[model samples]
Target: MTSDDAAQPCPMPNAHRRLMDCHAQWHRLHEVYFDPHEFRLTMNSLVQNLRNVTWLLQKQKAQLVGFDEWYLRFQQSSGSNEIMRWIVKSRNRITKEADLELLSELQVVWHQDWLQRTIGTSSKYPPRMSIREITNDVMRRYRPPFGTMTVRRRWVDKALPAWELLDATSEAYTRLEELLAEGHSAAAVPMCDLEAHDRECVTSSLRASGTRPHCMVDAKDDLEAHFDLVEGVEIESTSLVIERDEELIAKSVERYGSRAEIPTSGPIDAVPGFMANARQLMETDGEHGTFVFLYRGDALIKMGGLLFYNQNSKILAFEKLASQVKAMNADGVLVIAESWFARPTKKEEELGTVFFPARDRLDRMEALTVYAATRDGKTAGQISLVTRDASGRAICAEPDDMDDAVVNTLAPILRIWAEMDSSTN
Candidate 1:
């Protein structure tokens, strides 16, 4: 019989249900880790849920084959694991005397010029701020080198094992999941494999229905990468303007060879027409608003587009688009797009905004920033003043020189393009 068919005949359904509840509690705890009040509330719920799973399983031991032996082994093993022990103790403390104590520590690292420098470290509670808020605050207080920042806040407790609270909780949840899975095996009920499902949902906020799986924090890297892009404008603000001139072009050509070209000194009369065509294509083809154009010498060779999702997905989407560009074996790529971006602002922080909202506003000047890179590790960007009238008709102005941050952002794409070119030729 299939796992689902076997599960229908299983006698220890309540135990399985409790295990699912425990998983839900753990997931909720992870979702509100930043908010101290919500975190404490969820932690209590998680502890109780974990206890219920074992208690329910023990009560249904007779129905589950080999469950008594499994329980004995689980008790013996979990009693020895320090974090597991702490979890049991915390549950008792909550039931008898008071809430468990929690301490939060925040670490801020600034990545600039190929170096990771710790900008701030502190232990605090209650008024726990979100990462974006903390980052904006840091920018307001200190003028660090122009680069990205990663803010990590971990909750801990002296009463628990010397591990981050989340790490300890994850361990406890994993052990309980193992116990539940073992119980299912003993009852001859097929257990639904959840590892692959969890991986698929890693970057999403949506929770899985029915039996929830152990979620891996795979989005941590993606979130940090997104933060880099979100805070890039602030970092780039400090860059000294290198006017688009012969000197800059000469430097680019020296580094990347004859294929490297700077943004044209004069406005391209064809940009408006190109943008209009792109808009038409997007409207009719149901393609993404953003378009990538590959050029062989002065002729357009290939074109592709991707829908701009949230900031977290942007990095991967861009990488995918870049790979397509490299596959075309073209000399150059020009990207045209309009998207909202969150920028660091001291004013918002000063106004006592605890949470910096996602990108909500689109500036006209920032609307038409074009990123171009050649197959020889050469990159350039231009900001064209794109204005819309009351009827929403757009007027495109001559493109201006973009900052060094754009170049930094384009570095990976350029490197990949150059590598692909080398491999092909």
Candidate 2:
């Protein structure tokens, strides 16, 4: 060898880097599971990153003896594994064809005891009530037990396993990690446990244990049916309405204070200012109301109102309103409304005995949702149930779709506003 060649350092293979990159993409997939647009982007990225592991390994085959033989065996094993095969096919489809098809199922289950309590034990009622009747009866109640309502959302594809999308992805990740480890071993390279890295990175509390064989990634709890209660509620059958007027808006601004100065620290710092404004609007409105506020920095530009007969209409209305708001070149748009929210059964502290999981009772309630977006396409928001008593005193429900830190910052303020007399304000 030439003296110059002897002095030069040998280049290291980047297969390990590619493997870690693939793992990072997997974690991103978990974060964007609910957002279809973001999910697609992350899913495609994960596939590409995973596929790059082998490509990188092959690229550095000259440095690793017996790489060709080891890779051939790995390919055979991957072909036999269903998830691995799907991963390969997904990468090919994403590269050459269209995006992979995804199917989603939203299941809402009500416990048996909860239904009994809601309907009452009166024999005067029929064995079954029409969807409209049930909706009307539930809405008639001054305070519905919304916290007892359980909602489970799952995404799947015909090409994928029966498991939820996250679970399936976790299984795929496990196989890939094994392949990477074995490849490294065959190449005589030192490697840390990828599973350990995954545990440290994606520490979602929703993650279930022993759901998948040799799976280190987080997996959502499986949707299970209780023998004591009915299986699922048709989300389509539910109808809800939200109405707002100038009078309510005026009252809200007067009562909740026209301007709220949000702190520039903690989780609130990460959220857009307009979202806090929207939330303040909800807190002031206090009841079933929908509001649209356009803002430029801390200043309110224009305010509008919205009316929705159902959830679907509400969503469409927001979309149209967002488009209109964007066309007006506003700095930010805040949409705040109180509507029925259904999700997986969880304890609601405010409701007390109304949401008794030990007795297998569940309830549904109205939720105040605040959403904000900027002209630059940034968005942030929060969801919570703020109920009031006969005396107009606010009772803040457990926080939803937001961390405790954000809720704790806002809840005390809501209570304070609720105590103040509107006439004085």
Candidate 3:
């Protein structure tokens, strides 16, 4: 028995042993075939071996504890299941003159999903390794054996999956390095922030330098060496705020709207292709007095900013919004200012309105919560409450025992925006 076979103890040793042997014969079939006829022969043999293994498992179904989980090993994988199914269907129909166009399709799907190079513990095998030992070995060697003429074809096929893995792995390390350098604890850095920084740094670097490192081994080495630097750092949380009071909006309009070209400012609004993406941004309502407009733009594309619903009169309110949208049109997005619904403290008056840092915006989408109704020229608590996202999608709404007309006005607008589904709201 191999080291792996010895490690996993199976109750039915005879059945398990047969499965392992079947897996070995199937894997050896991956050897390169010099002739198309030889390739078809290998594929036929593999299909028959798979059929025998499947039949054996069905026969011993009661003996296995992880039959469902073990089967998932094949189903969860990208194209392995499809390849198996295709081969099974071609079994009786396959001839020595068989055209193996399906092999080309398999190459494309496998490369796209990076199913070839096994990495990480999670990617290694199923939890009950004994149950999957046979199938895993067979799948690893499913392809035809590489010959001198086929070597170049194999290299071209594997290049893309390798490059994609290298790029993603490198960017993850780069983000960790940036977060640690900024004196932020790894635990405190939200997942959204890590993803954002990874995309930004990789994109900027790629633009400046046409080439990137393709060595994952070196990348893994560097990550291990610096892992200690970020192990137990102190956590800190801070934010910069841009107040949405009257004076600031007037200045923003004059500054951004005056120029014929739009001014791109703030991380959210300065993303590439903002104009094209803005057309997709959705408007939504939120809890308390909060209103929002979520940019439906690509995650890589940035276009986020704040507008305020401070105007008391309905006519003036919409006019102010229209003006703000025109001024911020360069970024192509204008979310309602988060602070508009937040009660101001004495410290805020001194900060004024300009660019300021804040906690990751996406992370705090559901932070604000307040409920009030207008009565006797004063604001009072109301039982009914609602919350919505920038896309005008209602996140939550709780009806009171008795609904008041004044408070119910805060309900979400269900209008269908252009190019968006009418049922979305």
Candidate 4:
């Protein structure tokens, strides 16, 4: 028995030992296993080293596992269960109940994590590590205030999740050098006083330009970055108020008496084609508002700005806007001076009007909530322009609520036109 046991190498303690011997002697295969904590720690170490390359690594991970396949797995296991809820709640460091409640509401039941804050341990993950989910959570939290936020594809792998670890002594020394030199050069640029967005944009543009370093005025040495906020933005109103001539208004109303009024909608290609992008030429070529009368019917043809000034883009599109005014010459301005047509627009004609009765008119009722962007009168509201069918029952030309600006601006013009025209009818 002693001899047999000696030959058997004192018998392995467990299946693992036997497997290890078999792996070495018989199969010559290495039985590999990853230490969960150690592997995670190792990956976390790469965060500082590969800050720029983070996205690429995450993409590779996704590609190896197959995006669709791993996505399903991720969905199954991540940010779920009571433990996860506790983890999230425990992670958030915010102490105030209001702030905590806000965070809870923002994160949702599954993604809410408070473990890191509570445990006094939190690590920022790499690009692919835990970023996408967190980013998606943030996007979901913030409701779109303006049409500008069209947040669909904006977050598409834009920022890699990697924390840059700065060595205090070395970074401070390097920053001191950066602080001493003009920041225009990448070698010396200081990141201070510049907003985050502007700094990033300027840095990116400067890098892309590949221009040799030139003297920069008022360049700072140290880089300090923060998010940008608009300061004293000038918003010049695009609209204006114009005085109406009672005589001219009457004639316009008479010409528009509702005798089986016809719609203006037409085939998409009703007009003969010109240059495809003539909009610019018509908009900016002239001094101001442009108008034309159709000789065939002795009526106004399509009227556009004589000279359209694009304040935002700073591009002028004359001849594009159908301008005929100054410079080469002409000035960019409004010729008709904010005139709303007495009649409905060609689009309104196509959409057909719905009539509301006299009793339904809020003007007829007391304590009506007549909302206005800017009110003029004591009780500011619209005064409708009236027309009639064969029945002669009053039919005020109704404006749509969908276009508050257009309705508010055009209401007075229509009413003035109607009063002047009522005399002739």
Best by TM-score: 1
- lDDT string for model 3 (350-404, tens) is 6653232223233223322222221112222212222455766644333222222
TM-score of each prediction: 0.45, 0.37, 0.22, 0.14
Identify the candidate with maximal lDDT.
Answer: 1
* Per-residue accuracy of model 2 over 241-288 as CA lDDT, tens digit each: 323356875775677676555443322232444345555655555554
Clashing pairs in 1: none
State the lDDT at 366 in candidate 3. Answer: 35
Worst 10 residues of 4 by lDDT: 149-158
Residue-wise C-alpha lDDT for candidate 4, range 395-424, written one tens digit per residue: 433322223322222233233334333422
Candidate 2 residue-wise lDDT at 284? 55
How many pairs of residues collide in each model? 0, 11, 16, 48
Give the TM-score ranking, best first: 1, 2, 3, 4
Q: Which stretches of model 2 miss by more than 4 angstroms? A: 1-13, 107-151, 192-199, 202-425
lDDT of 1 by residue, 190-271 (tens): 5443222232332212121111232433222211222353444422111102222567546644543443232342223234
Which of the two candidates, 3 or 4, achieves a greater lDDT against the reference?
3
**Candidates' C-alpha lDDT:** 0.54, 0.49, 0.28, 0.23
Which window of ten consecutive residues has the lowest lDDT sum in model 3?
Answer: 147-156
